[model samples]
Target: MVRPGQIYKISANILKSRLQMTIRASISCNGVEIADVTQPVKEGVPEILNMRV
Candidate 1:
């Protein structure tokens, strides 16, 4: 159960941190650069939000 301000504060913090961080990525041997994660994520599974080859 969250308070009224919690969601706003949490979302704001996430946005702020994401914006402040570098977009540096790890590349696969196949030369694919995997980016952000998707929602409804499963534990022990990896999902790519964006990729560049």
Candidate 2:
């Protein structure tokens, strides 16, 4: 669960045994872009991509 007035970390995980790739994403609100992020994912590893309100 998420609550107000708190920061959170967004993450992505790769569960495959032999897969790797780069993730690109954008966060927007009201048609305005807030964050642009890129994260690399390796096999069986968790990537913390962004942390914001």
Q: How high is the CA lDDT of each candidate model? A: 0.31, 0.70
- The candidate maximizing lDDT is 2
Q: Give the clashing pairs for model 1.
A: none
Please provide, for model 1 over 1-53, each residue's C-alpha lDDT reduced to its tens digit, 9 standing for 90 to 100: 32322211111112233233323233334465333222333333443333332
Provide the TM-score for each candidate, comma-separated. 0.21, 0.61
- lDDT digits (tens) for residues 1-53 of candidate 2: 43445555678887875758887766667798665677888987888876354
**Residue pairs in collision within model 2:** none
> How many pairs collide in each candidate, listed in order?
0, 0
